[model samples]
Target: MYKKLFLSCIFSLLAICPILANGELDSCESEVKRLCQNQTESIKKTLACLKKNHKSLSIQCRKEIERGVKQEVQTKPPTGMLFSGGGGLGGRFSFIPLIKYQGENFGPLGSDDEDKKTRLRRQSVEGSTPIGKIGGGFISTSVRYGVTRFKEDQFLNNGTKVNDKLEQLELGINFNRPLENKKNINIRAQYGYRGDRIGGSDYNYSLMTGYSHPTESGRGRWQYFLMFSNNGPLGSNIPIPGVMYFYRTSTMNLLLGLPVLSFQWTPENTLFSLSLSTFGPFYNLEVNYGLVDQVQYFIFSRWKQENFFLSERRFEEDRLNLYEKVSGVGMRSALMKSSVGLELRAGYSSDRKLYLGDGLFNNDRGSLDLSDTLFLKLMLTKAFR
Candidate 1:
C-alpha cells in the first residue's frame, strides 16, 4: 500500500514541477496552501493538494501553468522589453489614446528562463512643478523625477552582477502674455528638457506655442486653448486643441473640457472629484479631518497613472515586444494653486525573450508583461496667477 501511494506522488510531481518553475504559481498560492496545508512531509502531499484544488484555480493561472506541460506550446516573443528616447513625459496628462513607445527589454529576461545573464535597472520622477502661471500665462514651470532600482542581486550566467541605476529629471517652462485684456485671451509658448542626471538635456527637449481664450457661452463661460509642440511623443508634436468651462455654484462645481474634463462636488468642508477621459479613470476625495491644527488643512488622496509605451515586433522569425507603464497614488494638502505630497510607484524589465503569451492583462496598458520595480515619488507644485 505504501509503495502504491509513493508512485501516485511521483506522477503528481511530474505534472506540477514545471509550472511552479515558470512563476505562474502565484495566483494559486492560497489554493495550494489550503489543499496541502498539513502535507509538509514530502512532494506527495503537495502534489495531491494542488490536484485537489485544480477546479478552483483562476483561468489565467491555470492556463499559463498548463501551457508548459504540452509539447506543442505556441512560441512567444523574446523575453525582456526595453525602451529609450524622450518626450515620454508629455503623455503625463493626456486622456487620448496613443501608440506607446516600445524598445528591447534590459536586465534579466524571463524570470523562469535559465542562463540569467544581462541585468538592468532604472529610476525617475514624475510631475514636479514649481512657480505656476503669471498674469494668465506668463511663466508655467514644472519639475519631475524618476528612478530604475534594477534588481542587482540577480546574477548572470558568468556570475557577474550587472546591477545599475538610472535617474531622470524633467524641467519645463511656458511663457505667455495677454493678447487682449478684456477677452482674457493669452498667447503661450513652452520649452522643456529631460536629462539622465540633474544638469538637464541629456536626451529630450520640447518647444511649443499656443493660445488660451475665455468666452461667453449660452448660460455659462468657456475656456479654450490650442497648441503644438515640436518634439512630442506623437511624432513632431502636432496641433492639440482643448476647451474648458469652469463654473462653481452652491453645492457643486462643473468642469468641462474637450482635452480634459472633470467634475467636483463640494458639500460643506468635504470634496469629491471624479474624472474619466481618453487616458483612464481618476478619483479623489478630501475632508477636513483636523489631522493637523484644525486650520481646514484638508487631507486629500488621489489615484492616477501614466501609460508610457508598448509595441510588438518580429525578430529572427520570432515575435518580440516591449512595454512601459507607470502608476501613482498620493496624499496631500488641498490647495487651489500649489500642493505638496508623497507618491508610490512600480515598473519592470526583462532581457532575453519577448513576452509571447497573451499576457496577464491586455494591450490597453501597452504590454501585459512587467516586473521588479518599486520606488517613492516626491511631488511639489506652486501656481502663480
Candidate 2:
C-alpha cells in the first residue's frame, strides 16, 4: 500500500523529534527574570536577550514576545486535528517538504476548443506526533503525502480522462480529556486515500467530538461538536452540529461557532499580524510582517475544496471534485538559528475547478475549468515549537 503509506510518514517523522516543545517561554516569565537574567545559557540565549531588550519589555511581556516571534516565522505545520483544526492550541512536531507549481493554463476546457495548456504539479510530505498520556487524554498523530500532476490532455465531456496523476494519503488522530468541570473533552479522527489513474480509488472518513466549557471568567471557551465527513457537500454527509467560542488574551485569538470563524491578532510592539479562518474545508486569510527576529513576510488568501471517490463511474453517482481560489505572497526564514526552515510562495489562481460529482446531487459527468493561473511554492521545514 504505497510502502505502508511511506513507512507511516516516516514513522510520524521519527516520532516527533523527541517531543518538541521549546517555544513557550511561560509567557515571558517575568520578562525573563527582568531581562535575560544572565541569559540562562539557553532557550536560544533567552530568545537572544529578549530580542535585545525589546524596548525594555512589560505590556504583558511585550505581547508574549511578539506572539512568539510571530509564530516563529509564520506557522504552517498542520494536517488536521490540532484542536480539530480551528486555531490549534498547543502541541508540536513537524516535518514538511513541499513543492508546487501551476503555470500552463488555457482553461475553459481547452483542447480543440483551443487554449490547451494545462499544467499542475505538487509534491508533499507532512508529519506530526505527540502521543503521550493515553487514557487520561492527550494524544496526537498525523501523516500525509501528496502527489499531484496533471498535464497535457484534458478531456471530459464523457470521454473521461482529465489528465491523470493524483495520489493522496492521510491519517490523523487526536484526543484530549480533562473534566471535573474544568472542561475539555475531545476526540478526532481522519483517514483518507485516493489514488488515481483516470478514475479509480477511494477511501475516506472524518469525525470529531468536542466539548470545552471553561468561560466562567477565564477569557473564553465553549465549544461543542459532532461532525462527520465523507468528503462532505451532499447533505454534508450526516452527523453535524457545532458551536464554538474561543477567545484568548495577551495578543488575541478568537473563534466563533457554527461553520466556524476564527481570528487572530498581534500587536504591542508589533510589525503587523492578523489572521482569519473558517476551518474544516478551508478558507483562509493571513497577513504578517516582521522582517526580523528570524524573518517573516506574508499575505495570503485561500479557499479550498477537495473530494474524490471514483471507482470507475461514467456518471451514475460519480465523484471527483477539486476547486480552489488563491492569492499569495510569502517569505519565511529561520534557518540561521535553525529548527530548519524556509518558505516561499507566489500566486494568482482563480475559480479553478475539476469535476464529476454526486455530492451535491448528480453533478454533470464532466467539467473542467481552470485557467487564470500562476502559482508556485516551495517549502522545507523541520519544526517542533
Candidate 3:
C-alpha cells in the first residue's frame, strides 16, 4: 500500500511543474508589454509583486525601468514663454536717480539782526552709470543742474547787503584704468564743464586725476586726488576781488590743488576723508596782479550704519604776508527712511589785521569776530537705484 501511494504523489508533482512554469512565463511577457507602453504605474505594481515572490525577476525589471526613466528625463526640453531683449545701446544698462532739497540759516547764536543773517536754497538732480568693463577701461558720465539763491544782509561786513542768485549746470566724464604694479591700484581721471549764472552768465572748466588703492584683506580702501580748474567771466560788472580790486570783470583765474585723501573702512562702515586745497591768485587777460594764496582743509567722518556724519572745515587766505582764517563744523543725521535728514553746523572766523571787507563784524573796541555759530539745516532726498 506504501509503494502505490508514493507513485501517485510523484505523478501529481510532475503534472503541476509544467503548469507553474507556464504561468510565470505568461506574467513576464505581460510585464514586458506594459513596460513598452510606458505604463509606469502597472510596471511598479508588477515589480512589487515580483519582488515579494521572485528576487531575480524584481532586480532585473527595476534596473531596466530606472535606466529608461533616467534617459527620458535627461532628453526632455524645457518649456516656457520667450521674452524680448532690453533696449540698451552699450550692453546692459542700469540707472540711479537722485534728488535733494536743502535749506540752511547762518548767523550768531542769539542775534535777531537781519543784517548778520544769510540764507541759501538749492535744488539739484544727479545720476551715475552702472559699473561695467569695456573699452580697455571703465567709462561713465554724469550731469547735473542746480539753482542756488543766496541772500546776505551784510555781504562783506561793510553793511553792504548783497542779494546774489546763481544757477549752475555741470557735466563730467570719468575714466579709470588698473595699474600694472598689481598692488590693487587704479588710476582715474575726470574732465568737466561748469556753467554759472551770477547776474549774467559765466563758464568754467575743470580736470581731476587720482589714484585708488583697494585693501588686500578687503577691510578698507583709500584714494588720493588732485584737481585744476579755470574760470572765465562773462560780464564786465562782476567783482573779481583779488584779481581786479573792486568790480572788474572778464578775468581768467586758475586754481590748482589736491582735494581728497578718502578712506573707507568696512568693518566699521566708516568713511574718513580729508581734502587739502589751494587757489592760485587770479590773473588778468594780460598779466597777474598779485598772487592770492589760499589754503582749505576739510575733514569728514561718516558712519553708514548709524546714518550719521561729522565734518570740519578750515579755510585760510594769505596775501601780502597777511592771513585770515575761517573754521566750521557740521553734523548730519538721517531722520527717517524716506530720504529725510537733518543737519547742524557751527562756524568761527578770525582776521589778524581786521580787514574791513572780510566776512566779520567790528566795533570801536577792536575787530568783532564770531567765536562760533549755532546753525541748523533740513533737507529731503530721494534716492533710487
Which has the greatest TM-score?
A: 1
Error of 3 at 59 (Å): 58
Candidate 2 vs. true structure, TM-score: 0.32
> Stretches of candidate 1 above 4 Å error?
1-137, 140-145, 152-167, 179-182, 185-203, 207-210, 213-219, 229-236, 269-330, 334-368, 371-385
Number of colliding residue pairs in model 2: 0
**TM-score for each candidate, following the candidate numbering:** 0.40, 0.32, 0.36
Candidate 3 lDDT by residue in tens digits, 1-385:
1111111111100110001111212333445444433432342333233323332333323222222211212111110000000001110011212334455444444456543443334455544443544655455444545554444322334332223443444554445444442222222222232222222323334444545443454222344544333321111112222211111011111122221111111111212222221222211111111110111122221110000000110111100011224345554443222323333434443332222211212122222233233334444444332
Please report how far candidate 3 places residue 256 from its true position, in Å: 20
lDDT of 1 at 346: 24
Regions more than 4 Å wrong, model 2: 1-113, 116-157, 160-214, 225-237, 243-245, 254-263, 276-278, 281-283, 288-298, 306-322, 329-347, 358-369, 372-385
lDDT of each: 0.31, 0.54, 0.27
Candidate 2, poorest ten consecutive residues by summed lDDT: 11-20
User: What is the Cα-based TM-score of model 1?
Assistant: 0.40
Score residue 124 of candidate 3 by CA lDDT: 50
lDDT assessment of candidate 1: 0.31
Clashing pairs in 2: none
State in Å the error of residue 106, model 3.
2.8
lDDT (C-alpha) at residue 285 in model 1: 31
Candidate 2: residue 203 Cα off by (Å): 27
